[model samples]
Target: MAGSLVDVALPLPVYSTFTYSVEGPVPPAGTRVLVPFRREERIGWIVGAGSGAGLTRVRPILDILEGEPSVPPELLELSGWIADYYLAPLGMVLRTSLPSALSDSSRDYLTLVGKADDVGTPRERKLLAALGQGGAPRRVRTLRKALAMGSIWPEIRALATQGRICHQTVPPRDPPVRTHRVVRVMNWLSDLNDRENMFRRASRQREAYEALESSGGSAELAHLLHQGGFSRSVIRGLEDKGVVVLEDVEVLRDPFREEIRAEPKKLVPTRDQAAVLAALGEMLQEPNPPPALLHGVTGSGKTLVYIELLKEVVHNRNQGAIVLVPEIALTPQTVSRFRAHFGDDVAVLHSALSEGERFDAWRQLREGKKRIAVGARSAVFAPIPRLGAIVVDEEHDGSYKQSEGPRYQARDVAIVRAARVGALCLLGSATPSLESWQNAQIGKFRLFSLLNRVGGGALPPV
Candidate 1:
């Protein structure tokens, strides 16, 4: 059993972090831990390591949310800063910083358990009628919207106790977690001599075994069936024969998919754009790379410079890059360019993604399968282990300032994150934010300017 109490931060209005005891290995900082708070169970992020410094009567951590901690130490520290600077709860800052799917909330719903006739009271009958109309689990809030009552718990509880309709607690699953079915060959198959004697007249089993072995000894069952042209029966037969093992493994669902595949286009940078790229490249080699402000007019090939810089950093240093756009609307255009250059190595994150998709993209980044993350302001929180660079496009846009909840400015966060990981931070804009421009003037940020448009297109004289 784990000893020492760990400090966890909840999204509640509380200003101080709470310490909780754990019964297993102490969850490292940045991991999500489930704990009993007040009268309810709530999910909180582990911000500090276990300690025995404070009061003795703290509650034990209910559970660690996942096998591995999702949030990185840099992000954990960044979130703490946001919490302090914005005067918001640490949990609220985390809620906005993390992918929506990771957070959990409690919900109450009514499920039809048995006959509604046993429900004696008129209000109970009304609740049962509402539950029947849905023919599915009806959330308390959803039923309340249909009924004309302020508090319906009395009737709901009565119906539940009578075994007519039951009130169920809907565990919060943001985008809802899911798993992938995978197949792996049995250990005995590792010996070449055993392959022939293992089975007789089992061609289907052989097919699955071959597919699994070909895929580095393990493959997603559905992928094997569809892509490898094998049937479920074939895999099942292999499993029964002890030729392969089948199991469900948790995986993220990808939400951002292109109906029409996008082709990557490379722009030939003009003289000015080439100079900016050169400057950015040089900046990356410095011991402490200064944050750069790429002050360019619209259509001056600023994005091309960013792409070039990202390619240089990731391909050369084997590190990851984050590209942040001001709005979700910009994600498509930005993602297209990044996808073209990085191929499947890029991941896009935004609010529009379902919980599963966001979780999947985030998992890909954390696993080092995807080296680039491009999305709205929240993309800054992407857990890219060895961050090489961060490019914030439209740095002047007010959309970077999250108005609600944590109210953090993404641009500043980008700079701080980059510095923490020894990465480059690039702020590109047509109309630079006044604060950023002032920073450049005061030499706080290294300023690089693109005076002329790419292809020598001149702006209209004012």
Candidate 2:
């Protein structure tokens, strides 16, 4: 509809979507919109649109925040399921799917409209004085602390009514995309022979070119120089000749920057591990496979089995996989192992990362730049394209249950999400949860078990 009415849900305690009018073109259902509500502006998600038949007067949506729908269609369905199944607030459930850094967090600040010399109350006058001294709008919280008032809303509201002050909401800031310099061999060069004449004249340039060619014909400028023992002049000269190209490419900011890179270890699976992996592989190929329960003992090498499966899912199938750990504290070790295996194809998601780091990581996964997502519970909701597998490590742990807001169980959500994308769900735990065990017992899930540890480490005599 060109100019129709839409229903939107605000992040409030309310249960129903409020109707609003659209003036020109209508945004898609999942786009965020700014609307005037109760004398203030509020951010809401557009759910659906219809003819405004029974309404007397409808307010027009103030602004469409994003050109594209912020929430994906699959997420919208998942949010609805969570709300219906858990009795959680629909708005809260939708909010949980977004990155916290991308939330509509705006703070109201006050600006003096006129002279604050004669304000209403003694406390109000003091608050105005503080605002006037700053010469700019001050956040409500800043005034509360400066004036030492427990609740300043009444005072602020009074000031607004007196026409002596103005209020505005400051939108949250998004982190900037990071970029780095890179070098690539020019296509015209074709082969080493094409550079033979130039190589004789400039030995250093030849060395740099050969180094880049050896490393797949592209590399970071800094890395190329370091590996070739060449100077910037050599690179510049090659660039001037059009033999090589230099450009800046956007790169994600890694949160664990100081951590040294670990090498992916090779392992030979035991007979039991091999048999189980084969069964799991068969399920992965099915069009609509059932969820799987991986039951193993404490010393069993379940993590290594997951690593092997992910390697095949990502490298062979060119698909994505998500690994969910139970705790934020466990993310670093888990992330390091995945990165060691998948290198740049792995992205980490968790609460412990800075807002920028998390945003960048999420972007990489969404844009198909990264193929594997690893972290705690929230990682289950990662925007993985063409998802092939989902691994819930420590599925029996209680930390996978979100205790606040939406109160969703990440393990359950992972299974549903995998089904939505035609991916295989693997719930691995030393002591399997009763729910998963029951599912395996009833044939809802395929069951596999790891019986012993690697390296023949015998258990203690008990």
* Poorly placed runs, candidate 1 (over 4 Å): 1-3, 49-56, 106-252, 255-263, 328-331
Model 2 error, position 31 (Å)? 1.8
What is each predicted model's overall lDDT from 0 to 1? 0.81, 0.82
User: For model 1, how does the per-residue alpha-carbon lDDT over 214-251 read when each residue is reduced to its tens digit?
Assistant: 77889888788788898778877777777778888986
Candidate 2 matches the true fold with a TM-score of 0.79
Task: Please give the lDDT score at residue 111 for candidate 1.
Answer: 89
Model 2: worst 10 consecutive residues (lDDT sum) = 169-178
Q: What would you estimate as the lDDT of candidate 2?
A: 0.82
RMSD of each: 4.9, 6.3
Residue 282, model 2, lDDT:
84
Residue-pair clashes, model 1 = 3
